[model samples]
Target chain A: MTNVLVLFGAVIFPFVVGYILISRVPQLLHTPLMSGANAISGITIIGAMLIAGREGGNFGYLLGMIAVVFATINVVGGFLVTDRMLQMFKKKGNKNPQE
Target chain B: MEISLSAIGFAHLLAAGLFVLGLRFLSSPTTARRGNMLAAIAMLIAIVATFLDRQIVDFTSILLAIAIGTIIGAFSARLVKMTSMPQMVAIFNGFGGGASALVALAEFQRLSVQAQLPLPVTVTTLLSVLIGAVTFSGSMVAFGKLQGLMHGAPITSRLQKWLNIFLLLVVLVLMFLIIGSAPSHALFVILTVVALIFGVALVIPVGGADMPVVISLLNSFSGLAACATGFVVGNNILMFAGALVGAAGLILTQIMCKAMNRSLARIFIPRQAIQAEKALHDASGGVSESSAAKSDNKPQIDPLAAAVQTLSAAKSVIFVPGYGMALAQAQFKVVELANLLEKKGATVNFAVHPIAGRMPGHMHVLLAEAEVDYDKLREMDSINPEFKNTDAVIVVGACDVINPSATEVENTPISGMPILAARDAKSIIVCNYDDKPGYSGVENPIYQDAKTICLWGDAKDTISQLITSFSG
Candidate 1:
């Protein structure tokens, strides 16, 4: 019963809330917004970590280790790249002309 | 290791709240960086909490994997150019999906070997692996097209639609079979392989012009796959984050589809069919071929001298940029030209189409990277009316967005699509490599307009030449 409820909440609730949240965003920030969301999807890192830390033998450990590597890349890379892109949107007075 | 499950759950709830706040802030530009920081912090909290969970039995390997991943991630994110952001995002999406699929596969294998597989766990595991595999392979194809490693044009045949449908059915049947029986590792493996192929098939028929939509859709798939992984692992924070990403990505995809004046259903139809139909219409003389043929004889001008003269005389000019500007790395030159024009007492502004570059807000990001003033960049609706009163419009490496056929011609590929009214300006100067048709395979008649001057060369070369001439 709990599983069904959790699955329902996971699938449907976020869709409703996320639609409302994203609708307010202007078109100019859409790319950064997508990148930011891409970063958030890296939440799979949690599951990957759990698997890696488990004593699931050699093959399982190998898969978990790779998963960890990939998820971390998504989290670290996604956030930093998004920040780099957003940094470019500074106001005229605050602009860094060097880049 | 001291934190209890409930405590971890509470932390996840708080993290989820921060993510929502982060997205809210990201809706606007000024606070977007702070929003990104907030989300990053939230991710940090989630990771740290997971590491502290009692279920963890090994740390050395996990930490080592994280170290390796961090080095690659930070380096690529820091080093990649702003113009190639879409390809970078695609690659990242692929990695995320691949990770989710691998986690699910590992968990399923462990459970099946232990004879402890439950129905719900089994279902979610199958789903995560399938969606994740597809997202992984599909995003690779998207990255290939964007990076020019593969042709940007859609590769499809008449049998593509049927083949995709058949493959989808096979995967579905295999999924049910796995779910119905004891965990058959071989069946799961086959399902993953089929799903991966299906992902490649799904993206191959999509043309480069529609890459933004493809990227957005793939982004959503990666999120949903993560959500399924969360279910398999029984992690609340992972589930919430996945849902958030899935929802946001879908909305973005819809917005991109709307901006292109294309229905989501129409976008999935192979581009070859659309092109073939248009070809048949053209052959039957449905639209006048005279203008297309006459384009070969259109007068070409000395772009540098003509652009300098035009800038010198014009009191107000609007610059329209497209994917070609990004392709040629000409955004900095465009910014320089705009600065020079502003100094000459001619007001300069950028007219940005919503779908102008490879992705949503692509031109805005490119110009922003070039340090173009935010106020000087205007959206399609706001700038369309101003074009008629504008003295000169300089088109930089753009085609379809400024194509007059979008507004003038009927029953064509780009008809009724919103475009900049560059044709209404006093004079139009186009800087591109050649007078070839744009991505839609439709010949642009604007190049043949008497007042229009074609400057055939790379955008960077031509724009810099104009800047030099203006300085002289």
Candidate 2:
């Protein structure tokens, strides 16, 4: 029972902090913010690593391997795309390499 | 072993702290790029710490899978056009959800191979599977709609709401069975299948124009699914990061819903009230006819020529862009025109509607990609009152955002939705595909205003013509 309460507390703590922090994000960077947050959600890869890297390489290994791939794609793709967009947003006369 | 566990816990704590700090910096433009880097570093720390776990023995397969994913992910991210970023995000969200679901499934499989699982594990695993599958399939449908692979209009069946209810009931029953008795593998598989179908059902009825809200909600679901998986696997880092993502997505969703003046429920299950409202407004058509008649009293002059004349005389200009600008790929030309106007000694600004384009901040991103100075872009609320003082407004492939009917009419599809006050400007130049109603299916009356010039054609061609005529 105590473990469950701690788990719930863990979830709630970040949720409230994220809410307060993200609400302050301006409308200008919403797309990048969303994609960046999406990338961080790929933290599930840690759990996937545990499953796939376990001693017994069986059915669970296959599922875990696939999970790792999916999570990696989300993390790598999400962050890069977000960066690509953030790089585009510039003030007047500021240097943008893509230009 | 005890010492190593404690060290790993400490590393995870540090990573979580960095993640929070990273998200905090992401809120501002000046530090956003650095924020992304921080988050990436935090991810690295978490992964390395996880590597120190004693249970991890097979690094070869894990490394290979990550390599494959990294190559595919990096290539897609690099090659995707700026305009297609929404679709790219949707697909990435799908993969994240799919991964979380798979993790939960693997853990459940490993546990079920032994005796009956604990009640907590059983519940969390089921929750993860259900929510993750829904996010995964729902995001794919969103991707298809955004990518033009599927129709953008709302696709519904006669029993759409009822079917969703039935699916929910079935899922509940399945979950109850798993919880009530022993955790059966076959039952779990059935539950996963049902959840996946429910996901498709949930998102398909939402129109493409409402995709911003749907995408944000699905993004939230993906995070919550990860959180559930964290609970199932007893991982603190996953839970913390997932919850943060959940919160971020919800905040975005709330903002989008408010910007569009739409209720979350109405976005998912649209009513026939809008059609009835449209019928009522169409019956009372005096407002539109009067405006049209008033416009007819002006001396006969070509709209494009009049627009050019207005542009030449105006000392202040505002540009309003929408999804049509994206479809026509006219951001560069629009920017070119804005620059030309500025060079002609006109004060220029961009009036960006909150719900403009396909996603939140979509128009700003497109304009930024075209090298428009971010300082020139103004949010709707701040720019609404300035429209009255503006000498001329250039609306590029936009309609609903500038539609006067949204405010004038009651209970229509877009009634009460905040709009860019383009009608308040002295001279309006609309470069739209046609004078047709926008995605809202409500006719825009501002096109018939006496001071408005409707240049009906592709925005790219029309904007180029404006630039050429102005330059010559």
Best by TM-score: 2
Record all residue pairs in model 2 with backbone atoms less than 3 Å apart, i.e. clashing. none
Tell me the TM-score that candidate 1 gets on chain A alone.
Answer: 0.82
Instruction: Give me the overall lDDT of model 1.
Output: 0.86
What ranges in model 2 sit over 4 Å off? Answer: A1-5, A96-99, B273-277, B280-299
Worst 10 residues of 1 chain B by lDDT: B283-292
For model 2, the local distance difference test gives 0.89
User: Can you write out model 1's per-residue Cα lDDT over B1-472, one digit (the tens) per residue?
Assistant: 2457777877887898899899888998889999999999999989988877988989988999999999999999999999999899999999999999999998887888855467888889999999999999999999999999998888878888888989989997997798789878899889989999999998888887888898888888889999999999889888888988998999999888877778775666654557645753663345435535655665555556776787799999999999999999999999999998888899999998878878778888899998898778888888889999999999998888887666666656666778888999999988987877777766777777777877788999999888888887
Query: What is the CA-based DockQ of model 2?
Result: 0.81
For every candidate in turn, the CA RMSD to the true structure comes to 2.7, 2.3
Residues B1-472, model 2: lDDT tens digits: 9998998899888989999999988999889999998999999999999989898998988999899999999999999998898889999999999999999999998898766888888999999999999999999999999999999888866688889889999999999999987868899899889999999999889887788899889988888998898898888999999999999999999999999999998888776645745654673474454536645776678887999999999999999999999899999999999989998899999998888877778898899999888888899888999999999999998888998878888867888899999999999999999876788877787776778888889999999999999999
Q: Can you list each candidate's DockQ? A: 0.78, 0.81
